[model samples]
Target: MNLTISVVLLAGIALAVVLRLKSATLTGAVIALLFGFYLADTDAAPTVNELVTAIADAVRGIGN
Candidate 1:
């Protein structure tokens, strides 16, 4: 649960940075966000969660 929140926060921050740099338009960001929101409700959510968790664990390992 904590990892999920962290990932979301991190992604949000990244999106904000991209927006500030004008690298991505607001419309594109909105579309991408909506895609992800809907994607989370699909069968692939579990796989995505597991992949995120694994990546997080690997990142933690690198800092150890």
Candidate 2:
């Protein structure tokens, strides 16, 4: 139930919908999956995670 995860999932769904509307859903999804797998094994993953966490924290703070 983490806010960051929720936001990410929602964003992903939105992206998927957009891709589908453009008739590129399957191709885009496959490419994205491959890219994600590649990124996950990189040394920069921690930095990416931290950046995403910071963004989520900032967004949360906006509503307070």
Q: TM-scores across all candidates?
A: 0.61, 0.62
Q: Write the per-residue lDDT of candidate 1 for residues 1-64, one digit (tens) a residue.
A: 3544444455556666776777767765875596577668768789999999999999999988
Give lDDT for model 2.
0.69
Best by TM-score: 2
lDDT agreement of model 1 with the native:
0.72
- Tens digits of per-residue lDDT, candidate 2, 1-64, equal 6555443454456566656678566766765675566666768689999999999999999999
TM-score of 2: 0.62
Among residues 3 or more apart in sequence or in different chains, the pairs in candidate 1 whose N, CA or C atoms overlap within 3 Å are none
- What lDDT score is found at residue 38 in candidate 2? 63
